[model samples]
Target: MPDAVVIGAGPNGLVAANLLAYAGWSVEVLEAQPEPGGAVRSDRGVHPEYVSDLFSSFYPLAAVSPVLARFDLAAEGLRWSHAPSVVAHPLRDGRCALLERRVQETVSGLEAFASGDGAAWLNMYGMWSRVGSDLVQALFTPFPPVRPALRLAAKFRAAGGLRLARTLALPVRRLGDEEFRGDGGRLLLAGNALHADVAPEAAGSGAFGWLMSMVGQSHGFPVPVGGAGALTAALVSRLERSGGVLRCGERVASVAVRGGRAVGVRTAGGESVIARRAVLADTSAPVLYRELVDEEHLPGRLLRDLERFQWDFATFKVDWALTGPVPWTAAQAAGAGTVHVADGVDGLTRFASQIAMGQVPDEPFALFGQMTTADPSRSPAGTESAWSYTHVPQHITSDAGPDRITGRWDAAEQEAMADRIEAQVERFAPGFRTRILARRILAPTTLQAMDENLHNGAINNGTTALHQQAIFRPVPGTGRPETPVKGLYLASAAAHPGGGVHGAPGANAARAALGHCGLRTLLHRAQRI
Candidate 1:
């Protein structure tokens, strides 16, 4: 029996296991998949010579995450590579809005669109410079982050606290309209907002959009050298070095409970792994509550709250092994690792509105990735490994495009959707289709099949909407990792600070478990020494 059993070997699970193991608690991590990394894995599935990230590729969040930084993954054979430009949102008329790693460069570019827009961007960055670290620290730590929150509140008060809070709470669209006279600065915020499920008009979208934009400016969206799996490999290596155990293909069937507390888990093969101290689950909140644990052990309020759990939008992805780089009409886009394909802000609005109305938009706004540009090791010299993803409704009522795609993601529908996505790419990169040597389409069903936590193809665990976040996350009345059941912690993206490659949820769970024996405080003391 280990001191801690982490149910899932995804980044979160691995992080939790690593922390526990480092604290001298024997840890065991069980993963259902044949390999780990979950959404963070990569492969040469599209072509033998090209490495395509199966799901997530870029890691701006990971770059800034204090949780991941403590591990010093670079020492464990992890290397990060960045593109010349961070992101580019191009329009049909060859105009582009670009995000450069240097704040001044980004400001200079935005100034071209409107005179004061650059200042507006700089102003936001200034705010970020003041409170960004503490803001991010507050977000990553357990909810009700008392110290960081106080620090952040102090910083905000100096900058007109209530006024700043109102701006953060504004919708992305409204924020853009208020701040910029031209569309360039606005487009960057809105595009980044779409990276989550939030639409431009959605409340509180401004904060996320601004956060992502500032993070991109501060830390260029970087990819692991070689492939995304390298990051996972580093995490695994670090865990092993700390004496943690990883068991792949060991599907946890049920969490064993005794006296209203999690004791261990039973594998599908009838193997029992006992956790003397704690059981930390990196599975989806729904799966953990509905499937892994019996209903008899859960509080009635939790079950009722779970009923309203809303998943983010489903995703459709395309991976390509290109003969050459994407031929973009706007030269800036060619050097960008990630490109947002939409005509303009209005076009993005149309696409998002269609998804909101349960219709697949005719012109999908694709978040395109040039993996080779970001990391040369992803493919051969001069060749490109590329991918793009767009949001779709969980359930479809109509098709806003010609293909009439219903909710059923069959082969024909997948091809049609792929074609539509490619068409959007080709609009920006005219010769995009010609450059594709091979292509693979991952529909919603395909994504869910690949990773069960991406329930119904909804990424981010659940919606990033204001109503489902923070204290409201996973369920109401609880914001921390502790579940209603003692000795059980929710370490998945479904926890507060939802989704992204950041390892906060996992680290929080490990600390929570360490609290059982006052190890967390002792560990901090040791670290200070």
Candidate 2:
């Protein structure tokens, strides 16, 4: 019997397995797909010589994640490449708001937008520089992160801490409106926040925006040198070096529980692997509770709460093999790794509102990533690899409704939706459509089909709203990786710290699993003696 059996070979699952293995626990990781990396995979077969990041590209959080920092991926053959600017928000007038690596450069960029906006931007960056490390440590660690929280409080003092707390809780829209006098800084914050399911006007959105923006400013949106998959390869290498085993193309049918304790898991092929210590799952909460564990095994209240679990908005992504770099109206945008294509901050908020109402806006907001800009080897010298994605309502109208595209993301509908996204890009980068040599579109259904974690196309695993985040994540009353099952734990993005490329969920799960396993080992040794 292995000390631990980790289902799913995503970042979190691999991280969990690595930690367990490092702690002298024999570990095994099972992946349903032929390859690992879950949402962090990459491909070059789509277009000859063009490397495209299948799901995720940028790694602002991964760069600063305390969990990942411990691994020292650089020594494991993982190299990061950063673009000149982290992100760029282009306006209709061809002016672009850039977030640069240097604080003063970013300040100057913001000053161009409005007077005193530079100072406002500095205030936020200043706070981030002082307490950002503590904040990152606090957010990424398991629930009740007392040490980091206390460190943050000490830095802010009593009165300043209260004020800072309120600032962190401000909605992105309010933060932008209060801190910025022009469209540049406001759009930057709102766009960054929209990376998650949270809307600009929603509570807790400001924190997301602030965290990511500061991360980018501190560490320009870094990408793996070869592709996003390089990071995964590094993690897998570390895990294997630590004596963990990884098996792919194996689908877990159900988690086997005996006497109310998770014993192991049975795969679709009818093979059962016994886990002597713990079973760490990197699947969604619903899949673990509703499908893997039998209803009779769960508490009534927990079942009810699982039914109410909310998912984030679905996403539609498009990858392109470009003839050349995107011809942006704003030259500064050409240097950025990521660009936000929208009317402005108001346009983004409107798009979010429309998504909330289950209405696909006429003008969609798209996040464009320039792969080759960050890593030139992504494509041939004269060509570029690019991709973009936009969020849509999770529950779309089943049938054709007034002024809607049926919301049924079939090939035809997907093509039409892709056209709209392209049009949005063309609005900022004129002649963008003409530059595409080939393109592939992944609808919500396609994305979910590609990765089970992206259930209903909700990429963040679950909603990141204040109500569903923190201790309330996965389900209220239990969010510290441990489940009601004695030896089962959730080590996926659905856990606390919500989503991102960070490996906190996996590290936290490993810690919890090892704690009990270590105690049991001592008990067994005593019994043998």
Candidate 3:
């Protein structure tokens, strides 16, 4: 029997297993997929010469994660690469709002839009500089993070506690309107906000937008040098180095619960593996509750609550092996690793509104990635490997556009949506389609097939909206990794701190398990006395 059994080889599960192994616990991570990496995988599917990130590419969150820092992935052969500019939003008029690595450069770029907007940008960065590191710590730790919370409370007091809270709580649109005179700062904030499913008009979007923008400013949205898989490879290597075992293609059938506690897991192959210490699940809450663990092992409240658990918007992606590069009308977009294609802030609002109404957006707001620009190793020389993703409603009731795209995501719908996305890209980068040597379309169902956690291509697993965050995440309960069942933990993005490449949920679960074991040992010693 291994000391612990991890039921996924995704970054979170790998991180949890690695931490346990590092602490001298024998660990085994079973992955359902043929290969690991979950949403962090990369492949040459677009072309044999191009490395296209299968799901996510950027590593800004990973760069700043204290949890990931413990493993020291850099020593395990993980190298990060950045583009000339972090992100760009091109206007139809050819003026682009760019976010550069240097704070002053970002400030200068914003100032071109309006005089005082530069100062506004500086002030936001100044706040991030003050609380950013501590904030990261607080975010990575489990909820009711006592020490970090106290430290942040002190810092928050100094930063005008209540006032700062109100400002951060403001809707991104309102925050933008209050801070900057022109579109530059607003576009940056709004575009970043859209990175999550949160709309600009949402209550907590300002904080999320500011957080992503600050993350980009502080850490220039780095990508793994070779491919996104390099980061996953580093994690796997570290886990193996520390004596952890990973078995891919081992689909966990059920959690073996002898009493009220989890004891081990049964695989799809009818193989039973014993976990003496704990079972850390890196799957979604729905999967864990409804499928893996039997209904008898769960509380009625949890089962009911799972019904209301909201998943973010379904994702539609198109990956391309460009012959040269995206021919952008706006020059700034060429150097950017990430380009946000939208008409304006109003256009973004319209897109979000359409999705909310359960309509296929007429014009999708594409988050386009220039992978080769960010990391040259992603493709052959002079050629670009690129992909763009846009949100569609989970259940489409109507088509806001003329294409009549229902959410069936059949070949016809898939092809139509891909064309629509390409058209959006073409809006900013004229003749973008001309450069595509090959393209791969990953519709919602296709994405889910590759990574089960990305249910319906909901990247974050659960919604990042304010109501579902913190203590309320996964379900309304203590925002810790520990579950109702003993010796089991929810160690996926479904837990507190929601989604990101950061392994906070896994690290939190590992720490919680360690603490439980320590406490149990202490109790046994006390009983003997």
Candidate 4:
């Protein structure tokens, strides 16, 4: 019997297992898939000579995650590489707003659109720099008592506390508009919010926008040296080095409950792995609450909350094995890791509204990743490995069981969507169509099949809307990782501090389980006995 059995081998699961192993408890991780990393894995066979990230591609959050920082992935064979420019949002006319690692360089680049907005951008950076690490800790860490925020506030006087409170409440759209005279500057801020499902008009969006923008300035949008999977390889290596055992190709059929407490889990292979102390589930909340645990076992209100869970927008992913680099109309865009292909702020807002209404935007605002530019080892020299993703409504109900949700894209339709995205890219990069050697498209439905953790292909797990964030995430009970059942905990993006490549949920869940399991020495003795 393992001291702890962590179900799922995502980043969160690995993090939780590592923590337990480090604490001197015998840890075992059971993963459904043949490999770990969950959404962080990459594929090379999808297209010959080109590697593709199946889901998550960037690492802005991972660079700052407390759990990841402690591990020092760089030493574990994870090499980081950044684009010359972090990201570039191309306009209709060929002008672009680029974000660089240097604050002054980014500000100067924005000055092309607005005179004083550059200074405003710098000022925002200054403010964020002071409390940015604390803010990240507060948001990524657990909520309710928000220990990081309280500690940060205590360090400052009463006035500083009030200022922080006011800043938190300030609308991001208003802040962006007030600071920047031109639409370019405003769109840059809005682009950051679009990284998640959060709308630019949302109250907390401003904070997210500012935070991401500042993070870009602090650390460029770095990619792994080989592919996104390299980061996962490093993580697995560290976890194994810490004495954690990973068992892949093991599908957890159900969680075993004994006396209102989760004791262990049963695998689909008819094998039972009993946990001596706790069971940590690194899966979506709905999966744990509705599928893993019996409905009758859950509290009434908690069940209702799970029933009312809101998933964010689904995505259509397109990966291309380009014959050559994307021929960009604006040369600067070719060097950027992320390219926002929306026309402007109005165009993006219109797309957002269309998604809200459950209609696919005719002119979708796509986020493109120049993988070859970010990491040359992904493909053959002089060629590019590129992938782009666009958000669509979660469930597009039609006569045939929800078109978007079912991922019923025939070959023609798949090619059509790919063509449309390529055309969108061609708008900024002429001759882009000629560069495609082979292409693979993943409809929302396909993504769900690939990783059940994505639910309806909602990347951030559930929507990052105001209603589902922080303590209200998944359910409004104990914001900690603990579920209604004793010894069962949620350690996925479905939990607090929400999704991203960050492993906070896993770390948070491990801490919560540790509290229940007792101190390091006690857990060790209990395991031995």
lDDT of each: 0.91, 0.88, 0.92, 0.81
- RMSD of every prediction: 1.3, 3.3, 3.1, 3.3
lDDT of 4 by residue, 132-238 (tens): 77777777666654578786676434337676666655666776777788766677778887888876677888777777778888887888988888988998998
Ordered by TM-score, highest first, the candidates read 1, 3, 2, 4
**What pairs collide in candidate 2?**
none
Off by over 4 Å in 2: 398-404, 519-529
User: Which candidate number has the best TM-score?
Assistant: 1
In the range 409-478, model 1's lDDT, one tens digit per residue, is 9999999999999999998889889888999999999998888999778879999998988899988877
Q: Name model 3 segments beyond 4 Å from true.
A: 519-529
State every prediction's TM-score relative to the real structure: 0.98, 0.96, 0.97, 0.94
Clashes of each: 0, 0, 0, 1
Residue 395 displacement (Å), model 1: 1.1
Residue pairs of candidate 1 with colliding backbone atoms = none
lDDT comparing candidate 4 with the true structure? 0.81
**Clash pairs (backbone) in predicted model 3:** none
- Can you write out model 2's per-residue Cα lDDT over 376-405, one digit (the tens) per residue? 989998788999999888887432223457
**RMSD of candidate 3 to the true fold?**
3.1
List ranges where model 1 is wrong by over 4 Å.
Answer: 523-529
Model 2 poorest ten-residue lDDT run? 520-529
The TM-score obtained by model 3 is: 0.97
